[model samples]
Target: MTTVSVPSQSRLLNRELSSVEFYARVLELAEDDGLPLLERVKFAAIFAQFLDEFFMIRVAGLLELDEADLGVRSADGLTPAQALGAIRERIGQLLTRQAKLWKRGLRPALSDAGLDVATLEECSDKEREKLAKYFEREIFPILTPLAVGPGQPFPYVSGLSMSLGVIASDPASDEERFARVKVPEGLDRFVPVGKRLVPLEAVISHFLPMLFTGMEITERALFRVTRDADFEVSDDADDLLEAVESELRRRRFGDVVRLELSSSASQAMHARLVDGLGVKANQVYEVEGLLDQADLSQLVAHHRPELKHEQWAPVVPPRWARVKTAGGVFDEIRRGDLLVHQPYQSYRASFEAFAQAASRDPDVIAIKTTVYRTSDESALVSSLIECAEEGKQSVCLVELKARFDERRNIEWSRAMEQAGVHVVHGFPDLKIHAKMTLVVRREADGLRRYVHIGTGNYNASTARLYEDMGLFTADEEIAADVADLFNYVTGFGRPQQFRKLLVAPFTMRDRLVEEIRRVADAAAEGRHARIRLKLNALVDPTVIDELYAASAAGVPIEIQARSICMLRPGVKKLSETIRVTSIVGRFLEHSRVYWFESGDESCVFLGSADLMPRNLDRRIE
Candidate 1:
């Protein structure tokens, strides 16, 4: 057998396509009948929602790159236009499988299980009357029909908002009008009629005539528009927060990257949408079944718990669980370093309980933490607020740049500020993404710092659904490093260096590469060398090159990348010693863990950062 090393770029895979493949993995779960019904339904919804975001951000950016002729290329060397073509082709194929999963599989299964998702045609006359009354009372007041004619410009289609393209004609005036009706976002995607659920768009389409008063509906089709929602704040903007909010306001009208139409859409309606939305034919997608299969989430829940996965309550390890209740979370950490594998272990018992105890502990002097994506009623945030109310010094580094979470973070920042907690919005140019907390407590010997570092957000809601890692340690070196990290984020100067932690945009990438090279050296020396990485994405070209170097040196490397893996593993000598796997299941795998070994010594690091260039070089993690 002959072995050859492929160039780094040659070994790279298209990031966008890899991301779609991740969604396809989710769809596989949805298509598999062995899983619980609602769990499969959940995956189906997640698959659609994932693709929606992929288009809104990734595909939209590519389309813009193509339009601007910037010649932007991905790690795999595909130009923007070329990537768009590949994406369109891939999504078209995925959509077919997705539609079949719903119409041919889940829909029938749900009907057999005594839950029906009925179309307008399937509704009985009595059911129709009931829905009509319900619509008039609950939905009619919010409906707005915009007519397009000589003076009427096509109504602005907001991104991801479902709507109806209506063709209505006035018999008396012989006037045919093209109109659009936006489905109310506040209402459920599927309305209840007896035991059956009806698509909201279908119901809206059924009553288009009443909305137009004198006009008769000739044809109607459900449609959705996805627009570019990605924006960057000016580094030197007078007010970064204001700039971000302004950009969010403008995001609604961003260039339409995709226009999805129901298969029932007439050629005339489709043509009108494409023109009005300024979307190209390649960007228009005709959906065979529901325009937004993500809405299936609303239709899938059943009264029978058997239809859903068996509820599993997170539990603390018996070792820590007893110690936590007996002495405290601090006592448990003081025993040694502790790891909380979330969902498997209760976030409430570990992270939340830790914060709550710190806030209430009279011996605790000060507390500092980072907030990226937290809930409105987060126990963690509330604990900080309580700590502040108790006149304890508390600081919060809230990253206002967390995508899709800017508004919520902004609101939380303001509330924390009002509560007298020292709130920092972090840098305008760099988002502080490290999930860490520092608690300074009065120990008998001296002031000892306790720290908690995690691979997921501090959001309690997601903790139950996202598989993450949290480490509680009283290690002085690591605690000092965390304190320095907070100082860098909140105060003037960065630490010359971190003693134990790998902070990003400064030392994380360099340290990671150095560690990888050390493993490669060990392999060359005929010593044991190995590496294991688990992250949401692995696309940094430099890091991939390093891994390739290590693999060629015979260093065994295994990676569990949940999405967007660029490195092509098991490729002859180029990556013969490296293996990559993506695990997609009931829970989202979001933790980032990196391990390296040389001879007998092993180094392990877990953090909020992934191996992507943005995370390692641009963001502050």
Candidate 2:
């Protein structure tokens, strides 16, 4: 519970700071002594990746606003500059904690468990000799060392790649010079010289003379770059695929947002990097131990079952096997709305089987779906290609601007287009984030459509790792609504009004706000009312204000967000009747559920839209 005077209160929390707190929770998992050894190790790796993304995208965004002097502020009363300062200080604390957790807790515990992560000095003479042979044969040939001098301006350093920034003296001239040797990304992050594992960077630093044969190495320090990778395509671009490919190329050389420098680095060395990379003082970080903890995933090679979480195999329901029949999926759905949960209920057995059956069924006349993110070797895309080959009407809206997944989505779009699938390569300003599929079959009585609306992507691999839900239904109104949505996406102009489905940038937000008001009114009239929400994020100011109003009216609100919630619950007079829980750990909670109840009336909704502003006002849901 939190209490604040009316003059000092800000009803909403900072989204970026809330995200940092979420990552801090992830770090807590890494520091947890109760979890399995490798499980904690996995969280450590996840924390690294999370921090990388925060710098690459979130921090980079704030720097853009700050540089432009736009002064973008949220309800949390923090401008972009203020948020960056808070983020930097808090993350510094987290990084300090992270380094200690790995060096003091995890590494030592793993060694005790017989899975040693040894340093160069810990290795025996025999192991050193073996490592020397392996490094020369497997790693040396792949290495490229670039010297920075008069003509060779600073070499272009890619984001997230670690490199050794070296200042060496030419013996003849006794003049110091700079050079960079990027640790080979192709090689494994950790190398196995003997029984123990060693960081590949350590081995590279150990044998620096092989590249600069005659130079005397004076100062050497490891550093990594986090570049501003976020990009937006102009709405006026003529060719989306070409534009997206160009953006991908530009993203490779984005501005350096964060610089991870070795704490042992000299002030002069730091200045060389600061000037060379064009990074400011605040953007540079000094960290001890590992620069990229994500590489700790290499511990999976230890093969100690007792040290890791037990492997899980998803169980498929027997009834889902009815997809063997040509119209089996439709038959199953026609009976009733079939709800599916992943990692608990097999995704391949249900969704993939539905697509496969739809591809092969001769009675099926059309298939439409949206692909925001999918597996590299996607069975769903394969089925769509086969359907198009069979001369059926097949349409796929592949979002090419899916952040880091742009290249993959671009490749998928080209493949689908080549296979005669009517492909829509996303819009310029908006991303179609809804996960749904529509299948129209030519039954004995005219035509009927079957639809699958989901809270997750059509990704088979992520299905085993993320907990998500979807409904396969043949409901007439819902199917028609989905059909109309596809027409709006694949066709020209605006979409026709939806009869049942709540489409974002249209009716979803309005409908949700209306329901919240209804619940508040019921509570104000002394009737029992309640609101429950389970989502990944909640940050839209309007919805949060509505929730606060409902809470003040005596309506109870409970929210379970898997990550990044801006609502501050249990504040007196403001949100005294509200509670929120962030569900993290194990599988990621991916499903979104909205339930509002007032006395005898009740309503429920599920979709990909979080209460975030982008989802409610900009993107399609």
Candidate 3:
């Protein structure tokens, strides 16, 4: 056996901080000089969008815990307040780096490429006159100004919406009042004026005088609000769709979690805005550039495709391509389990086409699938609807609790129901995050089941961006397990046991723990022991502890986690035998693969479950 160094501490890393670190790594990609100019801008936009979600969900949750006096401690042992403080500090640093990258790197590169984000002062007379006429004719009609005074109430600020806060004084009487002008979300963030582009906020600020005709604009500043958009549905809720709709309606009025303002804002202006919103001083952020850097997506979307990374179309995997020659889709899968890696391989040509064929096949009688998140152009849904119209039985477990996707799922569920597909809105409390599809077909011998399991959503658009894998198998045991799993989800009937697959909220955690201990037992017996895992996150304390124990027993462990790793490796006497690496690249690493070896026995399993507690014990994945 080989010797492995052990870390001194027996503790997990902070999950919140680990998540922040992941975003920082993305920002590092944005800062990479080797990347194409526009590709770097895209990374910056992704980083900003990631941070927005972090605040809206993670940070807001922590604040809520602190306020509720729950004294919740993370798997890494940080109190809610401690975690919040650390998050704010790290976020401040990242915000500075993001601002610097835009100001010093992308902005200059863009200008050099003749795609400048110019200001009002930078525009020439002709451009300025054109913009003035454009603004008056197009933007002015939709503008609504709300005032704050003795009689007027403070206007409601919607979450993530950009706005201009103004302090205007009556020219003759010197009477000052505060008001707000919301930047329409529908308009482009950057308006083009001839060769240059202008920030929407800058245009609105320059024309603030026009909006407040007789008032002297004393102070004007760009600002944005981030609110707690996370909500829960009671397990006993009678109607899941209505519950989600109600929460969506209430999301806009959620407590303000973050307030971002321009760095140039006067102290008086900042203080007034802060007080009016009832946000604490710690929640305020003064940004040096655009209020919402996510809008940089517009800059990335510029038509300068030459400055961006070369686009590559996906190729159909040869195995899938050979299906026609082999007889049919069923014959191809029956030959052996077929695997296709996404982005590098086209999902539409393979997995989606499989469903389409299944729907049309005369032999196929029943189709059952789990729907988490899919796009409007989803051929899977279309196929399922078509199957129903053809008098074939079809069932779709559309998870309405898939965060940020509840509305679309609801709409799809209703549409599927109208088309005669039995649509089951998933459990009220347990979200079904699994990616699965089963098709039962009639054959000369008997009824045969074909199943497709994947590590990503059924969304065709994301399939082009996310690195994932899908398996087409006709194995009897796995097929039976999938059938039972679908039955459990749709009929509230749980299986007594699984033959090959490790399921979540039941046996996944325990089985994983058992496998780790098996490796440790093998190591203790003076045999080779090893484990490998790749996942989007690793935060379950129980699983981490088992890995720590396995490390102490001299088992070699390697993890390639894309985000939120709580286990701290490389420390003495704790986790030295373990190694962790995160990959941030053009395609998102979203698949989860696990491998374990001990003595003569070895096993490999792939599924949708992450090592996170929510995935293991709470969700129905």
Candidate 4:
């Protein structure tokens, strides 16, 4: 018998292209007429924000790649520059589809539904008069018209900020001039003016003559700039927070990677804006209809409940519903293990209640947790503050490098520190991505540690929009493992072996691979074997190779990924037993669950780390 080997490149898909495909799915939701009107609008706004982050980080990284690295190719064999070109081409198609949807589908449908994003030309005479008065009194005072002159340099257009590029001509001197007027961030992007929602930019554009009073405002082009927002802090930095703060400051002046403009802009104005920004020609994206999809969020916020998805109220998990004692929640967890699913089960009743209970419990001597991401109104932050105030030791491992959430995490970390909690921003390079809480209580027996671990961030707002699972347990071995993990993060103590739990950057990847191989062995023996995975991404080459091998050995694999799956399923021989699907809908499928069966019993993992190299190798899951 002859054996054939499939090349590694043939088994994988480009990760960057895979991500753009995810957004394409999101855009499809906006085109879904079966969806509630405002729900469609919400998806549209989300898609725009997704693209913003994609360019800010992913494309920005590609643009900044050094000459040597740019030549290196990805798993599917496209070099960095080639990937950027592919991303650009795909983005162009997405934007075209998005624009068509907005103009032919959403906008018209919204108008018929009485929730329209209107133009000044669409306003009635009486409504126009009122809006004009409103603009002058409300928006005009906030506007500042900056022009390029002998002493004045071109204005710095902040990233993602919508600004008007003016081609103003001086009538007296016959001199052609250029100026920029920044749309006020403080004002609403859209304003309600009698029966419709008006984009604030139109109002600003309507009154641009007022800002550049005497000069002839020849052309008013609306455009947005997306600059490089990705940053890194040195591991050697003594003060990680200070280092991050410095990087953030430097991030503001990062080279502009993308320029978005109205499709109707004049040629001269377009060239002038592009030249002033020093952005490459290929980087500019001319948008039709609304220039910024994010600005449509104001329209989605309108009081039209009938046009949106039915509101969901997370229910209290039956276990915590009847608890009345100050620390009764912890006692209930000890009674039996508790599992709460977010957006279905109440986050407030589960995690928030746990933190509150720990703060109130005189028995709880200490509270330790990791903060990869959280909300401004984070219950854990307040709970930790309260616990610290009550003389309980409160230690928080705040990850200050959670991508776009860095600034907010920094703010939360500083707040925790001020409240006397031991706030430890994890290492600059090695991010602490695990989401778990360790509560030490002075019980009658001795020191009992209660653990709350989850497959999502400890954020209240996202809890309602993201699907996640969290476990509240007093299981001795798991509790001990979590405690050890916390110690390893804050101080130093790496256990040689973990009895039950799998801690990442150490045990997770190897353990998961071992489970896969075990199941493959069972399948090869003609026994029952299967693998099921639900995650945000799966790009780790090592794990992917193992999966392919398992599938070849007759093990059945089912993968449901939300974004960026490198694994190409349904291959004739290499992965005949593997299946892949992506689920994107009202709720973001944020939880990660990897279940493997050998014969009868199954091994399952639930955590924050995705099957990606960086998550497995650098992050502490």
- Model 1, 531-597: lDDT tens per residue? 9999999999889889988988899999999988999999886888999999988889999999999
Q: Which ten residues in a row have the lowest lDDT in candidate 1?
A: 1-10
lDDT of 1 at 5: 59
Cα miss at 151, model 3 (Å)? 1.6
lDDT tens digits, residue span 1-621, model 3: 233343423487888899999999999999998999988888998998998899899989988898998766776678888988998999999999988998899888889988888899999999999889888987888889999999899999999999999999997999999899999999998999998989988888888778999888988988999999899998899998899999999988999999999999999999889999999998998999867878888888777879887887999988777766312888888889988899899999888888898788888899899899999988999999999999999999999988889888889999999999999987887899899999998999999999999889999989999999899999999899899998888785656698877888889999998998999999989898899999999989788878888888888999999988989887777787999999989999999999999998998888899999899988876
Q: Candidate 2: what lDDT? A: 0.89
- Model 4 residue 376 lDDT score: 80
User: What TM-score quantifies how close candidate 2 is to the native fold?
Assistant: 0.97
Best by lDDT: 4
Error of 3 at 314 (Å): 1.7
lDDT score, candidate 4: 0.89
The backbone clash count of each candidate, in order, is 0, 0, 7, 0
In TM-score terms, candidate 1 sits at 0.97
Q: Cα deviation of 279 in candidate 3 (Å)?
A: 0.5
List the candidate 3 regions with Cα displacement exceeding 4 Å. 1-10, 325-327
Model 1: per-residue Cα lDDT at residue 591: 97
Query: lDDT tens string, model 4, 1-621?
Result: 113278867979999999999999999999999999989999999899999999998898887773357466788887888888999999999999999999999999999998777889988998889998998899988888899878889889899999988888989998878989998888888788888889888988987887876888888889999999988889798999899889989989988999999999988888888889998888999999887797677788888999988899889978799899867988898899998899899999899999999999899999999998899878999999999999999999999888878889889888889989999987777999999999999888899989999999999889999999999999999999998888878886555578898878888999998998899899988899999999999999889889988988898999999988999899988788899999999999999999999898888889888999999998888
